[model samples]
Target: MEVLVSEVVGRGTVLAGRYRVLSPVVSDLAGASAWQATDQILDRPVRVRILEHGAVAPALDAARRAALVTDARLVRVLDVGTHEGYGYVVSEQLVGQSLARLVAQGPLTADQARAVVGEAASALEIARRRGVHHLALRPSVLHVSPDGRVLLGGLALDAALLGDSGGDARSTTRADAVGLVRLLYAALTGLWPADPRAPQTPGGETLPPAPIVNGSPVAPADLVPGVPNDLDTLCVVTLGPNEDGPHSPGELVRELEPWGEIRASVAETATLGEPMTAQFPPTGAAAPGGGIPVPADHDDQDTAPVTVQRQSVRTAFAQQDPPGANRPGTPPPATPTRATGLGPVPSDAETPPTGLPLITPPAYTQAAPPPPVVRRPVAQATAPPPPPEEETLEAFGFNDVIGAETAAPTTRRFDPTALILILVAVAVIIGVVLAFRALFASFDTGASSDTDPDPAPSASAPAVADPAPEPTAAETPVAPAGGPPVIASTTSIDPSDADGEHQEDVAKAYDGDPATFWYTQTYKRDDFAGFKDAVGYAITLTQKTTVSTVTLRTNSTGGNVEVRATDAANPTAGPVLASGAFGPETVLTLEPATETQSLVLWITQLPPAPEGGFRVEVTEIALS
Candidate 1:
């Protein structure tokens, strides 16, 4: 009979007799459905995979069983059993988005992309050590949890059973690395790789490749403009060769250490069950037997009761069997023993029943009483041993251990008096050195002062000795402009070879074409001390052909400033349409002129100079 919603399986409708099924997480092609279940035993939430009746059921069961034996970083199978002809495997529920989602959003910042891949590398390293390989590390299979925990899904146990895949570990690791590299490339460049011969998915639809340039995977720098070279190198190295790269997850962790503090806060917040408002279809939310109402929000407090009940059930199972539990009346599986030596295998006469004596061969064999094998209780067996003494220093190499000991003296036996004396001596030495440095500095300062040039008089300074009689000239005033015209003024300057010549101090020089200087002063800065009084400066330009437009703008207060320009050029003399004060940064458009040369701009009026003399620098100009 098909199970219906709210139907209790085991103690409750949860896996391992702990979880309470709230709703379906996802339903797969097989009748198996993934559900969002609360752990009644642990008071936590988990995902339960309910298998449907199919040919793959037995195979999946075996895979799930095998999964329990390894140390792989693959998803942990919490419980597995057959209920009403339908098998289910309950595993940990990961709260995160798929790598595919992150890729689809857009290219990640260099740091973000590195972190994502670095995490995957760690998971892969763990799998490698445990002799398990995740054959599927595609964007779809890798999940970046909301808490930034990277979870790998879709193990290859079943695949191994189906084929003579001798290269399970190697192939999986290689493919995973390759796929991670591809994902990183996409994240950094917003482009896919260019592999023309690469086979497409079974349907003939091509998968996205790494970002490409000229038929080769493009460097991260080529894809994203202004990506740091170091970051680019990291991406390349990460994707280069797995064997030669980070040896293990620990090494990968070290490699990623240089990235500024990871934003683990996001992960922490996620772990605390912060509500996510953005609506996306729930993952792993399908019921196997019948209609079940999955909790819409995993973070909801109301779900705690269900989780508590699930935890109770889990606790009961734990007390019953525990992991590796061997119950009374159940014979432990026989362990295989191999005997190695010279002569033909001895018969029952030479070989002791248990085979312990055959390997050593006692001088005078007396039938030893059957050695009683003492088995620890399952609960005690599962408990970990006490941590070794000096645990902190163990992970570091011996050299590091010794170095740390020598460098950091133990304070327990230290003499305060002696330490104080030593500190005093050091302080005396430091003081002497500082005193000498101060003396020399003072001397140098005096010397510099003696050699310093006389300061120029301020513009408001009184004339010394009646500054030579003012020269008489015809008084010319255009409309008798007063107080700077109450000048709500804006200056628009176009970049050109002529402007380059007249403004050599401000224009950036280029080696390719001396006349074609790149616009370097696109950002506005308040540090332009000379242009304090100026209101604003707008640059206008037009490019005739496709060319990279370079601009450098600056303003006062070193506030927001942007350079804006069009890819095409204009023919008119007044291409500049408007100019405004930069409350924040302001982007002004410059249309290239049809005159073959990209227009150069100089805006001198916005920031008025003191004494009518202002200095605004526009260094470096280029069109390509």
Candidate 2:
């Protein structure tokens, strides 16, 4: 049953009992269609994915489940169920347009691209924290909303299906990062890596060349013009072939420091210290009674201590004194008489001029004893030998006090043993110095010997001895006259061939300008176990003109199918183009703008129907 865009719009009902269809968003060749819908339970807008009737249900289910566990950046799934023999999935509705669409509109400015990179890095960080790896990341899968929010969606779980689950999860993330680097490179340079001998489609068909212009590779600065050399280096380093590029999103975010702002408030807080109310501050309204005051000036006088006696005297004077009782209208107490050391009675005569007190002397008595001494006969004691006269060091030509000699200077006579030891030390030092000199000399000699004396002669010897033979005009191969025009192709499958093998599956040529032709293919295969039983086909195009652009399109006969573009000569050249779910039909346009001799098309894993094999067909090819 071929489903027309009109028919899908006509069938207005709840899909899978969860999503109520609103309008068709897009459809691709894998028979997968996206529709705007409202979730019954959540009451939120969601996108519904409806697989073709004969597509593999289990594989789709597996993918949905893996997405739920793997990536936080993916749109959340609300429900999954079958309706009218077709599988449908309810997912969160994104409010954004694909990055591809943005690029098509216009290349992003440097600042705009940087902002997008930050958002993408943040999203990837979230995924990394959750241990989810997005195996599929392309411009088409990356979306930017009207409000400038970036979202990443569409995860591929083919490896998970094959059970090669070891460190592949990490590898998958790195691979996706590399792919993003390539995409960024392409965006910057408008060229891709060269592939001249790529493989063709599984059938005898060939695909056009990639859309890359010229044979030039992209430079980081070209994509985001005016980027600093350091930033460019960082991008290259992060996207380099190192196994430890960045294991987590946080690490990746660190490389984007150029975009982060320096928070002034945070810096001020750090400098001023923590809030005063937090466990510590001043304890008084102004200065505490006994507490030290903060100095207003840098002088020590402000905080210096005064003598205690002076302080006490000042305090005593400050106290109030009692009134005197001796004279009328006068204070009773003045200065204390005891303190003045004056008598209590008043003197009748004039007081002495001095303010000192008069004192009386007391009489004293003493007893003395006297003793008589007899003359002693003193034998003349011989005076000890005159003590040796002190000889001052100064007398000996030295200062005595400053340089006193504690002992006599004894002449040190060198013994035979000491003399031999001295000689041995001198010999050892001489030997060591000579040995080091010889060692260094040898090292220098060896280094010089290793280097060729005439480097130029040695380098040019082979080239000069055996020069390349000059080519004769007759022996040189000349290109065909009027050289082939570049070929371009764009394909979008039709609903009629939704479940049948595409006509373009077989090798074919077109009568167009051979410069601008679009090619399409469709296929249907029943009995697929969601993983196996894939539909395989090839497209071959003769070199009527040098092919430039090659577009591979796919639509599911029943369910959605994954599409990948690779070198037709070598299938492992790695997919140059890849995407998820070509619903009814999706177009992949390649325009290399260079001469391509031939091209091949390849398709695989067609959705299987219970009744019979699904069908697919290619619709158009444009060459110039």
Candidate 3:
């Protein structure tokens, strides 16, 4: 039902009796135009939005909703009417620039962006609670008044009314939250991260989508490097495909208010020179032997060797000195440059021209040196000497007085001491095993004594006695040994007896499938009703039978309930047999109790669901 107009209205046109167009401000490709006009009746300035022919109904509906929101961050909607062949809405003229113009100049600082978006979130929360959604929110529609108030425009109202939202109220709210976050990101980075499903802005200029990693969009801090981590996470959770957090504007506002109040700079500081690897303490102005200068403190000078840097080692070795040299000013005896672990030292010609005292090797020594080095034979002695093991036993201080034949055979045989130790170990293991067997025998005797004694046989061992009276409902069933217990089939008890809808779903509780569950309808209060505190189901067997135990599996946590057995037509009329609080799963072993036809599971209390509802879900049930 779209209306087409043959003529276009221009400047100086009169509309709805007295309003006169003074100037055309902006005309969008979407067939919506804004004009600066004068209210001839009131003699004051006003802003007007001209809508295409068939758009009048939705435009007026949105204008009415937008008019109810009174916030400094939102533009004020005044009136809605049509003149000639066109429809339009009027509002107070705002004196400021659009968010697009502000961003075009340059990106806003982090604090500025926070303040702006925080204000927008507060305004959006108001509209959200009233069920009004701005699905067409974009930078071009967000204006900042001259007095520093944020004004969000409503180019989205018409689009939402036209059924272009493609989603429900909750989904539209999600989109609006995402849109605000996108605007914040654009303000902070000067780049728009568009959503493909969102409506196009007035101009038709397109923006690239945010970068995706794995399956989700990358965080803002990763893209720009200086965005605060908290802000980045907020944006990702609100706008990314995997988002499952805070789906409303109020929740978003709570997360952003603290960020706006923070005053610290978020920009990363730059390093002017080469990247730092490691830093060494600065050297003093002077040193002995022209080596790296050492600190003047007496304690540090004495301990310098332990804390000495590698740079000092090279300079120290270059100036040769004897093992125990004197202080810097004192002369010492001539000494050769010993072969330090750092290889050969420089010759006198290679030394610096500066005349300085010779270096004294510090007394702090490392680990003991290896065995004296042996120079290889000059004629290429490739054949290695026999191993040290081949030497005679005397080389290792072993006895040598005995004859060679006896000594050689004795040394080759196993030691008598090791043989004795192995025999002792075997004896110990046998003793331990025998002790374990003895202990097991004692335990078996104790267990046999604790078991019930078998019924004594009649002294005469004659004819069988008369048959006992038939068991009645008062008698409990005796379970046979070495057999699995029988399970009973379950059915949904009076569903209408509880909160109204989905009562038939309770049958799933005994379906034996964890994937399917029975749930109670959500109630305003935790208790199901004023008269009764519980809701439940019944399990009935084909014939009268005994149930030794029952198990209930619930997906929820924290609630009290009772299980009972009854022969009456209704299970709730039975006497309680077991009672306890609920967990992931509950198992109750019934004590000696009367036989019954039906079992009842009644929930006497309730807990809140994760999202502000009160209900209970049971996944499966078992009886033994």
Best by TM-score: 3
Better of 1 and 2 by TM-score: 1
**Tens digits of lDDT, candidate 3, 1-624:** 123432455677778877787776654436666778888999988887887744567667777777765555677777777776577888877555566656555455555576677767767777766567777767766766544556777834656444564378878787777878888877665567777665555463333445667555577676554566667887777667776656776676656642222121212332211111211122223346743223222223222112101111112223334456563334564554454565445456433344445443453144355444343332454444434553354355443343434333223455699889999999779666666654454334222222436432543332123222334443447764333334455544432332222455756877668989887655435665332345666666655667777787887776677788863246577567887766688886666554555677777776666666466778887777
List the lowest-lDDT window of 10 residues for candidate 1.
306-315
RMSD of 3: 33.8
In order, what lDDT does every prediction score? Answer: 0.43, 0.41, 0.59
Worst 10 residues of 3 by lDDT: 305-314
Summarize candidate 1's per-residue lDDT along 1-624 as a digit string, tens digits.
Answer: 245623544224645456676655433233345577777877877666665545445446445543543322246656666665556666667556555555454455555566566655555555555455544334555565543455666555333323323265555565555555665566565455532533322211123556444445657775455455655775566554334444344355445422221232232334322221111223123345632212233233222221100111111222334555564333564343334543234554554544445453342233355434343332443444424543344444432324433333234575699889999999779666665654454333222223446532553543343233332232233552222111121133332211222233332333323344322232123333221222222333332343233333333212333333322133234444323333222344334422322332324343332333233333223333
TM-score of 2: 0.34
Q: Which stretches of candidate 1 lie over 4 Å from their true place?
A: 1-19, 26-32, 53-74, 145-148, 157-168, 189-218, 228-261, 264-624
Q: List the RMSD of every prediction in angstroms.
A: 27.5, 41.1, 33.8
Evaluate model 2: give its lDDT: 0.41
Displacement of the residue 485 alpha carbon in candidate 2, Å: 81
Predicted structure 1: lDDT: 0.43
Off by over 4 Å in 3: 1-8, 161-167, 202-217, 259-624
Clashes of each: 78, 86, 0
